[model samples]
Every structure is written in structure tokens, then in C-alpha cells.
Target chain A: MSINEIQDSIIEDFSMYEDWADKYEFIIELGKELPAMNELYKIEENLIKGCQSRVWLHAHEEEGVLKFQADSDAIITKGIIGLLIKVFSGHTAQEIANTDIYFLKEIGLQEHLSPTRANGLVSMVKQIKNYAIAFNLKS
Target chain B: MGAITTGLNVQAIREDFPILKTLVHNKPLVYFDNAASTQKPKIVLDTEYHYYSSQYANIHRGVHYLSQIGTELYEKTRHIVKDFIGANSEREIIFTKGTTNSINLLAYSWSSAFLKPGDEILITGMEHHSNIVPWQLACQRHGATLKVVPLQEDGSINIDEVKNMISEKTRLFSFTYVSNALGTINPVKEMTAIAHQAGAHVLIDAAQAIQHIAINVQELNCDFLAFSGHKIYGPTGTGILYGKEALLDAMPPFEGGGDMIKDVKFEQTSFNELPFKFEAGTPNIAGTIALGTAIEYVEKIGLDNIFAYEEELLKYGTEQLQQINGLTIYGNSIHKSSVLSFLLDGAHPYDVGVILDHLGIAIRTGHHCTQPIMDYFCIPGTCRASIAFYNTKEEIDLLVTGIQRASKMLL
Candidate 1:
């Protein structure tokens, strides 16, 4: 599926629950289901520090397609990362770099995108974009 | 709803703060972030509005009627702060931006006058970055060594460790009266006595204490004390730095500016009097006057009563939170204030904080600018709910429910 298609699906999935608690529960479940990154990749170099939480992002490219793995100590942040990974992973670096993600607002998690929130989600998105840009330049 | 056991009249007190009626996410706002900054009372808000609307003027530099009123009200706050903290004189109270600015002013001025090469400056591990960074800069500027009084397992400092740390080489000892992160109320009088005995000037960071406890600088006999106005329901960009008259008189001016100088020439300039010398530039005229109003409001309620009521809330909160399984609280000191810092097993603080935020509960979740405390506990951070006099048992119950709900959702 396209990135927009996946984001729409996620938004639709969130729309099934009207209550904030249910929305968060779904995110928590997604967090639990996210594949854990290799412990070796969770190094100081990959770490993105926030005042409230920590995130680590790792990216590598294969055959002009980029794959991303990320983790956060915070479950909500991790769930958000899982959403981003699902949207961006297995896509070409050029396609990933060109995409303008707007699903966070659609899914009612736009607060995480604020720099003042300090949940590392904003930095993670920036890191993903930078990784895509670097890979695109190389390819 | 009228009054609680302490006769504090929590209901009426709640009404004084209009923001207490605010709703978040279709739920009533339960503010538990008092340590970060207290919500202003209607009187403080009105006073700020009234000042700007009617009595706004640049103080000390103008001869207009509004400027005179502004200068009078601003200086009235200085006297009120002097009396509020029981300082020896009005000249002892120097207004600054906030606790951070106050500490920086002291660090720069005092270290320039007193700190020497090989001299040692002591501070506690649980100090806010404001307290730690200024002294570090002072030590760097003056070729001095910085020492730390370590915290115990329970986040309280050992008095014996403090005594052992202070020596003849210790030129200054700065520490917080209460840990902003842990809510540990240190034995300020005893520690000040220890520092004085060692011939070291002491600075008490009262940023967290001035609101929750009664303070008397003369009784404590500390060389300097600093507190922010916003944390005490006053305006931001306003604070008090209470120092000994002799010490303040001895130090050089912190910033060379208009109000802080007696006379200025290209070749030579003379500094102003004690308080004005430290308080350079055009001050926060309106905020300073409103700070006086805030102090009056707190005085009307009485600090002893507020302290008693908050202690009860703290005890109730601690007891309720202790019942939750897999929850660990930091700062187990018996002499604690209204702050409760905790972490749930296997649930990150940020996750818990986000959940609570959705429940209309405002709490602080982070290292709270006390990274050393987090390092000591070997954790990233904890969820902190700092109570105020206006907070009630019902609010705490809501907080308990929110935390439980968060744990259920995250775990």
C-alpha cells in the first residue's frame, strides 16, 4: 500500500474508537505488538534524547528501498513510532523522502509532533526524513 | 466544601483561582504541577491587569504621576518581601527575573568578590539545574573547585556528609531548601549553621520552599536566599534575592545599567545602593507590584495554615499512591513537602504522563531539571504530582484514579 493509504487506514482504525481511552488502548496494543529492534542497534549513536522520553532510530537501505527500525522507552511514543515505521518502511528512499506525513493530526496524536512535548517523536520523524534523504542522495 | 480540617476553606480558595474551573478534554482540570508553577489567583490576575491598565509606567526614571505610583507600588513589594522572609531590611530584598536569575546574580557578584583560586563551593546532588549551573560557572570563572553533598538512598542528604564536605577551603555552600524533584525538605537551619561554622557563605535556593513553608532569613541566618515569584502564585519574571546587608554591600554590581548606577562617566562610574546595585536595568515594574498583591493574598490565608493543609494532602496522596502495586516512590524523607514522585513497574513516565494528560490531570513527568536525582535512582524520570493549598482530597482521588487508569492502559 502507499504511504497515504496506510495513514488513512490507521486513521480509520483510530476512528473506530470515539473515546480517548480506547484510542490510547489501541496505541498501547500496537506498541506491544511492535517488533523490538536489535539490542546492538540501541546504541548511544542512534539515541535521540528528549526531556520526557528517549527514542532510538536505525535505518538501512537494500536494493534502493529503505527499511527503518525504531524504539522508545515510552509505550505511547513507541506506538507512534510503530505507525511511522509501518508507513515508511519497505518503500524506496526517494518515495519515503518525498512523502509529507499528516496522519498524526488525523489520528489525534498531533501533540507528539510539537517540539515542546519533548517525547522524541518529532526528532524521530526528523531522523527518518534525514535517513531517507541521505539514502536518496547515495542511490 | 467550605473548609477542611485545617480551616483553610479549600472551596473558597479554589474559587480564588479562576483557572480551577477550567476543563480539559471534556473533563475538569486537576492541576498537580504546583512545583512547576502555581496557577494565579484572580486577585493576582486582576492586579496585573489593573496595573497595566491604570498604573503602568517606567519606575524610578520618570516623574509622572503614574511613574510615581508604579515606583511606590514596586518599592512596597520590596518591603513586603523583606517582611515576608523576615529579612533585616528592605535593602536586603533584590528583585530579579526569577530564581535562576537571582542565583546567577549572586553567583557572579559573590564569586567575583569572595571566590579565590583553589577555593571550594559546595552544593547538593538534588539541586535544580538553576542552582547547579550558576555555581559551576562561578567555579569556572574564579578557578575554584565545586563539591557536592551526596543524597542518601531515600533522596535525603546526610548532615554528617555535609559537615564533612565543608572545610576552610569551602568559600561558599549553596543548596536548595526543598528538592524540586523529590520533595525532600532539607534541615536548612542545621545546614546553614554547619556552613557558617566552617566560615562559608551559604545560599538557600527557596524556589520550592517559599510557597510551602514559612521562612525567616534572620532566624535561618543564611547569607543569601532565592525564590521565584511564579511558584508562589505571583507573576513570572519576578523573584526575590534576600541577602545580608553587609554581604550585598560588599559585592560588586552584577550588571552595569541605568538604575544600578549612581553616576557614570567614560572614565569612571559609581554603583548605586545595595538592592538597586544588584537589580540593574529597568525592572518588571507591573509584575513587582502584583507580586506584592500575591504576597498579601498568601499572608491573608497564612503560610502556617497552607503548610498544614498541604501536608495533609501530601500524606493522603502518599498513602493512596502506596496502595498501587508495582509503584515505587522516591524521596521517602519524613520531612517532605507536597511533591510526590513515583514510577510504575514496566511503564515509562512519559507513557503514564500522556495517559494522565488525556484524563485532564496535569502532572510533571521528567527529570524535573534535577538530572542528578534521576541518575542517583538509576531511572530516566518519574511522574510528579505536587499539591497546593487549593487542591483538595477529591482532586487527589481523581489523580489516583487517573494513575490507575494509566497503569491499566499502558501495562
Candidate 2:
């Protein structure tokens, strides 16, 4: 599926929520379903700074396709990271690098997140893009 | 004033702050982050509006009617602040941007003149970055050393260690009156005496203490005291740096500009007198004026009553928070303010803060700009619920419920 298609599905899923409580419940559910990262890969070097929550993101290029795995101590942060991973992972480094995930705003996630959490979301996106850039250079 | 009756009409007080009436996430807003900043009372807002709408003019420089009125109102705020902090004279109050700005002023103006190459500046382990970074910069600039007074487990500084730390080489000692993150109230009066005995000038960072406790600079006997306006229900970008008149007079001007100068010539320029010497350029006139009203509002409510009511709230909050099975409260100081910093077992502070936000609760989670304290505690950060007098028992009960919900969702 295209990145837009995945984002649309997420948005449709989110639209079912009537209030912030329900929306956060959905996000927490998403967090529970996220694929866990390797404990060894959760090093200081892989940790994204500036997040109130500790987020560890690991990316490696396999056959010119960048695959990303991430984890966060915070459930909401993890859920957001999972969304970013779904959009950016398993794609060419070039394609991932060129992508801008406007789906957060389209899905009203940006508006939903508190100001500080919004900052964390931005940091998560930056870290993902940074990984893509590093892999793109290696390719 | 002796301990007044706790006749604090919290409902009426809540009415004074319009923000308290608003909804957050479809629930009644529960503001427990008073340490970050406070909601302005209607009077403070009205004062600012009144100044801009009716009493607008440039202060000090103008000889006209509006200017004269503005100058009087602005200068009158200095008097209110001077009396508020129990400083000797109005010359002691110097308006700066905030506590950070006030500290930087002292660091630059005072340290540049006094600090010699081997001199030491001492601060405590629990200081906010504002109190720490300025001295670090000053020491780096002047070839001086920055020393730290160690903290006890409950987060109070060891007074004996502070005495031992101060010596002939220690030229300046600055510390916070209250820990912003941990809520430990330090013994500033004794610390000031120790610094004085060691022949070191002292500066008290009252940014956290100003709202919760009554401050008397004379009683504390500190040479310099700094606090921000916003923390005390006043406007942002406005704060006070109360220095000893002799010290302020002797120290060079912090920033040289139009208002801060006596005469401007091509070859050389002389400086303005005490407070104006520090207050350069177009100041935050509206903010300064509004701060006077905030002081009056606090006075009207009576600091004694506020303190009593908040003490009761603190007791209730502490007892209730302790009941949470996995919740660990930081800073178990016997003497502390209305701040409650805690960590839920196996749950990140960020996640806790986010879930609380969804429940219409406002809290501060993170290092709280005091990374060194976080380092001391060996934790990333904490979820802090710093209460104000306006907060109620019911709101705290709601916070407890929110935390339970968050713990179940996150943990």
C-alpha cells in the first residue's frame, strides 16, 4: 500500500473517536501492537534526544530498502513512532527521505497532542528522516 | 502578620482567574503546574488593559502629562516590590526581563568587577539551570572556578558542607530559596549568614519561593534577591533584582542604553543612577505596572492565609499521593512548598503527563530545566504537580483519579 493509503486508514480509524479520552485509548492500543525493538539496539547512540520520553530508533538498509524499528518508554510516544515507522519503513531510502508525513496534521494528531508532546512528535519525525538520510548516503 | 485565620475563599479566588473556569479536554481544567507559571487574576489583566487603553505613555524621559503619570506608576511598582520583598529602599529594586536576566546581570556586572582568576563561585546541587549557567559562564569568562554545595537525600543542602565550601577564595555564593523541581525549601537565612561570615556576597533565587512563602530580604540578610513576575501572577518578561543599595551603586551598569546613561558624548558616556542604571531602553512598561496590581492582589488575599490554605492542601496531596501503590514521591523535605514530584513505577513521566493531559489535568513533566537535579536523582525526569492557592482539594482528588487512569493505560 502507498504511504497515503496507510495514513488514510489510520485517520479513518481515529475519526471514530468522539473525545480525547477515546482517541488516546486508540493510540495506546496502537502502541501495544507495535513491534518491539532489540534490547541491544536500544543504546545511547540510537536514543533520540529532546524527547520527554526515551525513544530508540534503529534503521538499516537491506537491498537498498530502509527498514526501521523503534521503541519508546511512553505509550503515546511509541504509538506516534509506530505510525511514522509504518509510513517510512520498508521503502527506498530515497523515497523515505523525500517523504513529508503531513498525515499527522490531516489526522488531527498534531492538534490532539499537547504542546510538549507535539514537540516530541516533531523530534520523532526528524530522527526518522535522519536515519533515511544516513542510509541514502550509504547507498 | 501573625497566622491569620484560613478564611481563604477559594471559590471566590477561582472566580478572579478566568482561565480556571475553562474546559480542558471536555473536562473541568485542573491546573497543578503553578511552578511553571500562574494564571493571571482578573485584576492583573484589567491593570494591563487599563494601562494600554488609558494611561499609555513613555516613562521617565517625557515631561508631558501621560509620561509623568506613566513614570509615577512605573516607579510606584518599584516601591511595591521593595516593600513586598522587605528591601530597605526603592533604589534596591532593578527591573529585568526575568529571574534569568536578573542573574545574568549580576553575573556580568558584579562578577566582572569582583571575580579574580582563582576566585570561586558556589551554588547548590538543586539549582535550576538559570542559577547554574550564568555562574558557569562568568567563571569561564573570569578564569574563576564554580563550586557546588552538596545535597542531602531529601534534597536540602548540607549547611555544614556549605560552610566548609565557603572560604577566602569563595567570592560569591548563590542558591535557590526553594527547589523548583523537588520542592525543597532551603535555609536561605542561615546560608546567607554563612556566606557573609566567609566574606562572600550572597544571592537568593526566590523565583520558586515568592509565591508560596513570605520573603524578607533584610531578615534573610542576602545581598541580592531575584524573582520573576509571572511566577507570582504578574506579567511575563518582568522581574525584580533586589540588590543592596551600596552594592548596586558600586557595581557598574549591566546594559548601557538611552535610559541607562547620564550623558552621551562621542568620547565617553556617564551612567544613570541605581535602578535606571540597570533598566535600559524601552522597558516592559505595561508589565511593570501590572506587576504592582498583582502584588496588591496577593496582599489583598493575604500571603498568610494563602500559606495556611496551601499547607493544608500540601498535607492532603502528600497523604493521597503516598497511597498510590507504585507512586514514589521525590523530595521528602520536612520543610517544602506545594510541589509534588513523583514517578509512577514502570511508567515514564512523559507518558503520565500525556495521559493526564487527556483527562484535562495540567502538570509539568520533564527535568523542569533543572537537569542537574535529575542527574542527582538518577532519573530522566518527574511528573510534578506544583499547586497554587487557587487549587482545591477536589481538584487534587481529580488528579489522583487521572493518575490512576494513566497508570492503568500506560503501565
Candidate 3:
């Protein structure tokens, strides 16, 4: 979708929900729309150890860019992985390195997470960034 | 199942927890996250209140009346804990901040002596991070190997594999009696037996299990058992370490402080006795005294009763969750604690928890600190509702209704 379309949808999402509860409901609903991942990424090496849901992620750096895929036993968590991939995928190590996930806060969701979930979020980002760092070292 | 004070009436019991009466968004707070930390009962609250108000003084070494009272109360908690867990003696119990600290004390003191290069420390795939990370550090320092016993698809540890995994190289084995995330109740006696045969000391992270199940430390006979009082409806920053008398006597002091030393010379100093050697600095005296009262409250309610009530709640929750479309509960173990972990069809667990919170129902939304277990299930995190004896079927019903509403709103 174009930036205009995305912004319009976000505004619609804000208006669509009546309250924080509704907003969370809508956000979770948004998570439901995320596509499922292939089964190959479900191994321990690819699995993120701290999520409440079993989340698996695989990334390969190809032609100076990184492409990643993620899936989870949980649909909504898959949706979270989907959201993360949308932000981090196809971007260079440098792009991923430079990106700030403050949008989570701007979207008014970070504070809603328990400290445990928040830490998992940090781990997820760190894993991606560390992967980028590893790629940087290799190249 | 028979001893539960479930017949005692939840309304009266709920009244005892001040947090239950507090309103959130004009709704009574429905706290379902008891596996994390239970809210203080009135008895525990009053105990702390009384301690600070009347019995505030330095314990173990005091001449005044207030100090005398403080010392007596503090020492008495050790005895209460001994009776609470069915420990063989009061000397077996050592006070610490919580389960994490107690486990660290064992790791640093004993692991330092026992673990060496190529030595193996056995653990389970279902251990909480607190149980996992400390051993990881110990292994890293000593060049010891870390081996994990595989968990069955239903989240139960494979005891056959546990027995097979034991070897002469195995120096220590530690696992949770009840998994904080999945709520899988491990067979502590059998697991401890396997470790002892392999000549390895076993540390049971009883943090979750002690509150939910009846504990008989002597019967289980593990080398060390650790649990936090907060999980058992006691005050925070207080816990117990139940070690074998010989083990406690042999292990080195965990910290250097005013309480843990015999006599400080310019060159060398002797350490204090069994329990004090491990309890360094000014401990959480108020919390410890309050924990004693908390144990009294649990005993009054009764452990068998607590377990039975939680089992009923778990069964009820599992059945209700099964009715929701696009929902799948994880860890289908026959033997389980009162925690329910599940994934909503298309909703984030955090989103579920957040939405539920607005409805005045509080649930934990995350990995429950067992990140490695989360990895095994192949998800980012899960929505967990941990029930306590104080929770009611009515609350579970409201929780189900709220989830139904949430599912409609989200999916």
C-alpha cells in the first residue's frame, strides 16, 4: 500500500475503535491478517527463546540485502512477526541498523506489553540487528 | 483435591485481598496472573504492618525489647518455613530475597566448587530463565557442559530421557518442579533420584510448585529446593532455600556481610553458622516475618485445598478456551499446575492481555520468563492466566465472557 493509504487506514483504525479495549481488539485483529510462514523455520536454531508463543525466524543475506521469514504457533504472534518483517525485510544491514522501532510507541502499544513481552521485543530486534552485524562482519 | 477451602466462600476471601476491591475503569480487578506473584492477603499485610510499627529492630543481635521481639519473629519464620514445606529441620532453610536469589546462592557457592571443565549441568527445556541463566553462567565459567532434558509435546519432561541423560560427567541437575510458563508439574522425586544416582546434586526450582502443590522436602530428598514467598501470597523480597543439613554445612558463604561472619581478622575471618553464612547483610526481616504469617494463611486454607481449587479453575478455563474458535491451548499435560497458556486465533497475546485489562481482568501476556520454552513452542509469546485458590468460578466465567467479547472484537 502507498503511504497515503497506510496513513488513512491507521486513522481509520484510530476512529474504528471506540476505546483502548477496542483499539487493542483492532490491533489484535490486524495481527490475525498476517500470512503464515513455511514449516522449515521451526527448528531450535531459528526459534526465538523468550516469546510466550513459539516464534521461528530465518534470514539470509543475498546480494547485499537481507530477506527474512518468520512464523509462530500463534496467529497473532505471527502477525507480530509479520509486522516486524514488513519493517526489517529487504532492507540492507545498514538500513536495519539505522531503523528505530519507536513507531511501536507512536502507535501507542509498547506500554501495553508486560515487562517480559517488552524484553522479548527487545530480543527480537536485537536478534535481527545482531544478524545484520554478523552479515557486516562476514562481508 | 479434598482439602480445598473452596467451601470457605470466595467473596470473603476476595475481600481479604485489597487489590481485588480496587476498581479499574469502574470495574473490579480480575487478577488471573497469580503464577507471577500473588497479591498479599490481609493477614500478610497486617503482619508487615505490625512488624514495622511495633517490632522494628536489628534481629539476631539485639538487647532491647523491640530488638528481642524482632529477633524472635525473624528466627521463628525459619521454623514456620520448615513446617510449611515439611523440611526436616529449621537449619535446612536459608532466607533470601526470592527464588532467584536462593538459586544463585547455590550456583555461586556450590557450583563454584563442583563444576569444572567438561562437567555437565543438566536442566530441562521447560525451565524459567531464572533457572536457566544462572547455570549457563556457571557452565561458561567452569567450562562445564549444559545438557537439556527434552520436554514431550504436551510439555512434560521425558523421565526416561532424564535417566538416560545422567552420566558420570554430570555434576549438577536443576529443574523446576512446576514450569512457570507451561505449568507442567515434574516428578521431583524421580528426577532427583536420577541425579543422585549419577552423583550429581539436584536443585529443584520449586518457585511455582510450592505455592500450588503440597511440599514434603524430606520425602522428595533433593539436595536443594528454592521458592519465593511472593508466589505463595507472601510479601515480596523474601524466599527460602531448603538444603540438606550436610549440604548447607559444607557450602561456602554466599556474601560477605555483618551477619555472615564469625570474627573479622586483618588476615582471615571465619564464617557464621549454616543459615546465617548464606544470609548476608540486613535481610528482608519485615518480609520474612510477613512470610511466616503467609504460611499460616496457606496452612489455614490448606495446600490440598489450594491445589484442588486451582485444578478446578484450570479445567474450567481449558474447557472454556476450547470453545473459542481459532484458539489453541498449549501444553496438554495430564499433570499440570493452574496456569493456562494459549494462542488466540489471530490476536497478539499482548493485545489480548491489554484488551482484557481494560475490562478489569488482568492476565500475563508474554513468555513468562521461560524464553527457551517459548522457542520450543514456536511462538513469540502466549497469553497466560494463572489461577490461585482465591479466584472463583464466577471470575473464570467473566474471564471467558470477556474473551468471547474480545474474540468477537478482534477476530
Per-prediction CA RMSD (Å): 1.3, 2.6, 5.9
Report lDDT (CA) for all predictions: 0.92, 0.88, 0.81
Q: Give iRMSD, candidate 2.
A: 1.5
Candidate 1, residues A83-137, lDDT tens digits: the string is 9999999998888889999899997889889999998888989898899898878
Query: Model 3 off-target regions past 4 Å?
Result: A1-139, B1-6
Q: Which portions of model 2 show Cα errors greater than 4 Å?
A: A111-119, A130-139, B1-5
TM-score: model 2 vs. ground truth: 0.95
DockQ of predictions, in order shown: 0.91, 0.70, 0.27
Which 10 residues in a row give candidate 3 chain B its minimum summed lDDT?
B1-10
Q: What is candidate 3's lDDT per residue for B20-47, written digit by digit as tens?
A: 8889867998889898899999889999
Which residue pairs in candidate 1 collide?
A: none
The predicted structure with the larger DockQ, 1 or 2, is 1
User: Which tens-of-lDDT digit does each residue in B1-411 have in candidate 1?
Assistant: 233578788888999999989999889999999999999999999998999998888899687899999899999999999999999899999999999999999899999999999999999998999999988988999899999999898889999999899999999999999999999999999999999999999999999999999999999999999999999999999998999999999999988878998999999999888888887788888888889999999999999999999998999899999999899999999899999999999999999998898889999999999998999999999999999999999998898888899888888
Evaluation by TM-score, superior candidate among 2 and 3: 2
Per-residue alpha-carbon lDDT of model 2 for A6-120, expressed as tens digits?
A: 8788788778777777777777888889988998899998877654777788888787787888888778788888888888888887777787677778666775345555335
